[model samples]
Target chain A: MEHSGKPNKIRLSTNPTNEALSKLKIGDIVYLDGVVYTGREGVYMRAIEDGEPIPMDLPAESAANFHCSPAAVQNEDGSFNMGAVTATASFRFSKWIGAWFKMSGAKLILGKGGMSPEDYKKHFVPNGAIYLTTVGYGTGALLGRGVKQVRALHWRKELGLAQAIWVIEVENFGPFIVESDLEGNSLFERENAKIAENLSKAYEGTRPAVLKRFGETDDRKDELI
Target chain B: MISIDLIQQTAETLMDKAAIEIPDDYLDGLKKTASQEDGDLSSFVLQAMLENYQAAKEDRRAMCGDTGCPRWYVKMGNEAQIEGGAIALEAALRRATANATNGVPLRPNRVHPLWRTDHDNNVGIGAPEIEYGFEPGGDWVDLITVHKGGLFGTDYRMLFPSDGIEGIKRFYLDCLVAFGKRGLACQPAIIGIGLGGSKDTCMVLGKRAACLRVVGDKNPDPKIAALEDEFKELGNSIGMGAMGFVGKSMVIDCNIEVGYCHTGGMQMSVHAFCLSSRRAVARVFGDGRVEYRTDPDWFTDYQRRDTVEWNIPENQTKSA
Candidate 1:
């Protein structure tokens, strides 16, 4: 749990079908050094519906658009291009965890916004899964971390950038918080419940002027009309 | 007759003046927030932001490249007459907008919804978003222009109107919680809360509030002042810390602007600007008079010292 120069590490195995879900803990820090596929909103939705392959490599023309190269790729300066691979928002793809684990062997999820099903905390803790939230609106800072390689697997080319799976090598890709752990405590759920509760209280308490002006309800009563 | 050419020229001048005037207040607020806190991370972020401001000022570059949708608030006098009226006003705005885009070298930020074409000068369908109001006594128009600087990420996406008065408190908390969850490491960021408008309009108002001067400055309404204080306290208490990781202060100032709403519905929009809340307001009179205004206390140490590279056009003279 102490901070070292290297990223926090977690070991994941995929020999058995259920191994991916069985090995995770509630609050374990994980560093996924191996290759993992990347998918965002549209790709995840399509994958869940059609079971498509995510592409792992960018075309030669597309490669030039990359902000950084893969860690294995070297520049004229002889330094590793360590790019941070961010996971897309969790809520957009929360329902596809089973499919993602089945295909990609993804051990870590990196993103900014929180996830759903407040009780997923226990699911994460016991299953060796973790959700890490990167800083919001700091894509430049995240991109500055560098890139070594871009890889994708099993996605339609027509989908263009949105469908490709990005396998990026990141250095110390953290300062992220665990929203869901193997123990099933979901930060997103906790936050939403708090929001819903506060919203309910506010709804019951205030009688804004607009409500009276609009006559309160849509129900058409003869007397009011 | 109001000339479109004249309005365009005025808009350009207003934008140029805004660019140099706004960053100082933002930088000062960031520094003040960081100094009040007791943490290494918060301090580091603040220092970095200050450096960012310095570099931007030195190069005469933008504090943050986003330089969001330029918003214009126009107040016209009932007695004031435009030769072409709204048409003249629109032409003036478009001209000023084009000038600003070229002059600032501003990023072509606007995009067409269906076509997705970049409006190279930050002008697009319903863009350089303008709001119009009329005052009874004036013979001319007064324009307040604000260009907000920040990344429009999830913060822009999370806005929802409150169902009722009770919704106001929740809306307030939602903003703070959203900031805590996703905000940067810097504290004392400007929180703009707009209550009552259509969904999009409310959000724009929230951003406009952020682009306005800090609280304890000037706002016409006392009710708004009270709400600002309440929200500020509530937001700071979230323990989101500087930059929202965990710290004593979460925001430097909270500004709330209330607008008229239709019956039975109230909307609240919240926008958070990072510690560097770059904002400038210009008051232009009917007779071609213009004055630049900033929060008096902001960047007090740096006031009256022209460290920023402000290339005011030599031909254009400042009104006395």
Candidate 2:
């Protein structure tokens, strides 16, 4: 850590260099105080599977691609004013997630929902890429506040905002969770096991006992709630 | 008579605002859940969410970018009159959707189910779903829009009429445990349970309860309302906090909807809504007055009664 900071908010004082991210473990809460690119549903597939060149100028050799679909408005001057870009489900693009990581030398991939655990064990650890889950759905627009500028490129009109690749400049971005890390760790599996264990213990109790455990606060004991 | 222009204007307004405005009820629920969050990580997740809400509001931008597909539930009064006939509602919705797609924009989410031929507009066959409900006496139309994100799950089961509440609760818990424990489903979500209907009807009702009803709204049925109050502790007991970051408050609210079915069988199901809870309503009067509503008051439209007082602290550890 470059500076002592609040526990609730860990500041990554450096760019998310591979060497810097190497020390970061699963479950570590930190914000990326640096730049990341906004790729789309097919960005990885095009670059890796189709052997297409990536469309961005990448300020750095190593990068992070947040699966984003930012709504863009064309000003009279013709520069697009970007509004909102949020995470998407990773499962659809799981096939190329690792390839993008290895090819682009990405330290991180941010999106919504989960990716396959099989891929986590197979691709993420070896490639040194971590899958981070971000706040998605209704909050995408607010996330746009992190963007300083958005430059649209190749297939910008054909693919529109959702599928088009964009180079986004970000500063102090992210409150995303480290769901899967380069250490071959999956928080999804970990939390699943914990909940499964808790459920087992919960089921062992008698029905009335279980009800009493949670329903103790309710006044009407006769109710079937 | 309400003008076609008014309906078009209403749809256009809803198309933009539905994705932008975080409803009053949902914001209240977020505050309630945040206040009760147990762990530092989970609490911080919520705190950041609240900040994002503020930022989105001030910037007049979408809270989250997904803004998913848009769906509308329109409730019309029997006495309502419209210019250019009833078909104008659909026409208005389509034009408004196109306008929103181009301008006060939404993500072009509608794609062909099989081939993925995205229309680039958030409209397609069987989309912008409009369900019509009628009231006895009024000259107005009420339209509620749920800017739906990806749905995580829908579950249904046939239960004997004799199966009763235990069976219903068990089914709901099973579904939530199986599908909702992951951060994929998000946390501090709303749970909706549908009871006493045919298989498909129950599933539909389950979705309505999940996506349409107000967070923390009680079911009219006393028994269902009681269960709604308990689901928080019950869901938290499973231990999936906000975004599954780990904490106590998994489900912040639950709403149940029930319908009568043929005597042969009773069916039940469960549906879940993520924390974003994006829904809002707008109404058009025959005289051409238009007003937007943040409080949907869905439960008041149905009658369910309960008299249970449970005031568990939000931060309390779920324990034996």
By DockQ, the best candidate is 2
Native contacts retained by model 2, as a fraction?
0.35
Which regions of candidate 1 are displaced past 4 Å?
A: A1-225, B1-6, B16-26, B78-84, B138-140, B149-167, B184-188, B196-208, B218-224, B259-267, B273-278, B294-320
TM-score of chain A, model number 1: 0.53
Q: Can you give the lDDT of residue B141 in candidate 1?
A: 63
State the lDDT at A199 in candidate 2: 65
Candidate whose TM-score is highest: 2
How much lDDT does candidate 2 score?
Answer: 0.67
Candidate 1 structure quality by residue, lDDT tens digits, A96-152: 655654454444555545454442553344344556543322322233232335443
Model 2: what is its DockQ?
0.25
lDDT of 2 by residue, B1-320 (tens): 88888788788788778777777777888788889866655676777778888887788777777776788777776678878776877778777776776665567777777766666677788777777676545688887878766556456777765555655656666666655645556556777778777888788788888887877677766876887887656777766576655566667687878888879666878776766667878888988888888665555432232335433335432520
User: Which runs of model 2 end up more than 4 angstroms from their true locations?
Assistant: A1-15, A33-35, A57-62, A73-78, A114-118, A136-138, A157-160, A201-225, B298-320
True contacts kept of 1: 0.04
Writing each residue's lDDT as its tens digit, candidate 1 over B247-307 gives 4456667776655666555667777765435455544555666555654222111221335
